[model samples]
Target: MRTDPTQPRLRPARRGRFAPSPTGDLHPGSLLAAFGSWLLARHDGAEWWVRVEDLDPPREQPGAIERQLRTLEAFGLVSDGPILRQSSRDTAYREALDRLLGSGAAFECWCSRSDLAATGGLHHACVSGPQAGRAPAVRLRIPCGESVAFDDAIQGRVAQDVGTEVGDVVLRRADGFWAYQLAVVVDDAAQAITDVVRGADLLDSTPRQILLQRALGLPTPSYAHLPLIVDAQGRKLSKSTDAVPIDDANPLPALRFAWRALGQDPAALESCTDLAGTLAAAREAFSPACIPSESVALHNTGVAIAS
Candidate 1:
């Protein structure tokens, strides 16, 4: 399905998403990821979607979802479709889980974190079958030596043996909350996402997601993992660190910094007077070739690694 050399690469029907979990204000690292996905989708003439991953009621702040979207909107990175929230999509996730469960590809797991730790999480001993008395967690039964490999848009060849390296992935926690891996996999398929442009931190998780997609007979979207923004201490910048929020009222400095951090020549945008101009110039200049394979440190962002 290669594009013709004489034609544009974008399709009007092509879709991308900047799915975020609402936990706090937008910071530099989070903004960088959002801007990256937004810029790429717009550059290719694709429809970009915003999905709020608000599945975890306990961790999510009361008003953080609206605030996060407002921040992206303030920075001119708006979604093309009606915003989708995971909280409203439980039926979809459950259906997908049911498919796997009925296929015998998923099973009830009763192993606690401590139980898994004691048995070496990657081994067969860690996978406890359904127990009558205990609350059960749903986990995918990965075939042994399930070696999956894919070429990343930016990071290049990535390969993972999920069965050995990651063990069985939890689809639903004992608390009954849909697991991040399963929810994200189901949501991406539901949205018809053509590409996934996000931080490098989630690169390792892609194989697990791909396994789920295959088990459920869903299409796997192309992936591009941007370098992560870290701090002076080399720790990934995140909400847990209380990352400083970016100022949406004055976004130029942060945009410029993000542009450079993504390996683009920011000097070309010197003539652009405003945020729109900067964005316009970026649409022309955005190249996966320019983005680096490794993660780089950015000062702050009030969120954790998102994909």
Candidate 2:
């Protein structure tokens, strides 16, 4: 099967996702993430998927997942694929953990938070020996001087030495729950996600995910971390009481606000009156170059501070 040199190679279609935890309602900050991700996907003529990160049941609110999805729908940010819920994907995570453990890239960790407190909350070795009745957490064994580096589509070149800066990160908790680091890596690879566009708060976690992808022999997706939307006090919208939930009944204001927060010109959406029209205009006017690399603050009225 000889190939012709004149033919251009075909790149895999871009697949992007917006995975949200069901900890709370769809707030302005989250809307910014969803809108940014959806806009980028649409602008690239790619598929956009939604995933519910319902792994932490204790932290998740009842019916929050449904409400969040509904809000996205109301804002015309619909998923192109069937929704994926992390709660139903434990088997996949377990298999990924098993592979890492078998390859010696991961190990059973018996150290508690208190046990590693002296090491500034980083786990290098088990401080507390195995307890008789305690369950052990699983962690990746970050090799000495191991460094992960990648060119973020938006944030530019980013690098991190997991061994020094992060140390060993947990895969499965002692409480018998799968850690987010493992589940997210597995899910993204499973979904063949080519580009990850999310909030800048997750920028630091990108290297860890890339490390996991290497350990599992999976392809690392391109990353584009959008600036996070914080409250007036400079707290991330998710963690702040000032975070306002998007009112799906009247999506225009929030839609326009999110559009502006993405560094896109709000004038692109000013002519729109409905969700579909606003999204379409936004997609047409979206410029990856316009997106800010720094987090922006939002007032309770959905206004950007010097934005």
Candidate 3:
């Protein structure tokens, strides 16, 4: 199960995906990521797919996934295949974990969150113990002193000391649900995802996922982390932060604004008569270099309050 760094298997290149958790309505931030990912796939002439990461039942809001899908359709962002729901892939994840366990690349740890919190989140508590089957979470046993590095399409040549920056991270949670790092890595490999475009909020977690990719013997996908939209106070806009969701009732204005937020100068509001035209103009003018690398606060004007 140990990922041979020198000989990591390179899968045949294919398309990309946008995997979003259905915890809330699609907000402006999420829309930015979706649009960016969609455009990237289109630019490469690759099939774009969508996956609903609904593994955490407690955090998933009822009906949120359907609402998000409708919103994406409203925004004119379509995917190629039937939407893949993570909840339906439990058997696949379980088999991957079993393989890792059998190969000794993964180990069961009974350490609770509280236990790890006390030791700064990276301390190994169960390196050696009786193979107890107490409701333990599975953790990828990271080899100490190994560095995981990847050349991010946007960030460029990023690296992290996996042993210290991220400890033996969890594959399965104490609640028996699979952790995002584990599921995302496995799914991306399984789906043959070539590129991953997401918001900058996940920039810090990229190195961890790279380590997981190394551990799981999977091919790593190219990544482009888009700039995050922040509030006036510099906080990332999220449901818990009370950030407003994208209004599907009138999406043109919001789409226009999102294009601007990503550093595109669209035609004036009066120029484009409809949403489709505005987005078409955007796709033609979309350039990754135009978007800012850092988070910025967008004024809630035409897009946020469009009738």
Overall lDDT per candidate, in order of appearance: 0.83, 0.88, 0.79
Q: What stretches of model 1 exceed 4 Å from their correct place? A: 1-12, 123-133, 239-242, 299-307
**Which candidate, 1 or 3, would have the higher TM-score against the true structure?**
1
Any idea what lDDT model 1 has? Answer: 0.83
Instruction: Give the Cα error of residue 286 in candidate 2, in Å.
Output: 1.1
Candidate of highest TM-score: 2
Q: Per-residue alpha-carbon lDDT of model 3 for 1-307, expressed as tens digits?
A: 6787899687555687888899988988888888888877777767889999998999899999999999999988877878889999999899889988998888888776566676677845564444456677889887667677777676677788877767788899866999998889888888888889888888778888887777678988889888887777778878337477888988876777677777765554337778777666666767777777877576543345355
> Which pairs, if any, clash in model 2?
none
Per-residue accuracy of model 2 over 1-307 as CA lDDT, tens digit each: 9999999999778999999999999988899899899888988888999999998999999999999999999888899999999999989998999999999999998998888889899887778878899999999998757798999988999999888889998999999998999999999999988989998998989888899999999998889999988767888988998676788888888888888888888678778987678777887888989998988878533553221
Off by over 4 Å in 2: 300-307
Each candidate's TM vs. the true structure?
0.90, 0.96, 0.89
lDDT, candidate 3, equals 0.79
Q: Which tens-of-lDDT digit does each residue in 1-307 have in candidate 1?
A: 7768998666447799898888777877788799888877887777899999887899888889888988898788989888999999989999999999999999887888777785466544445667777788888998779889999988899999988888889999998899989999998988899899988889999999999999999999999898888777787778337377778677777787777778888676668879789888888888767887767765432223321
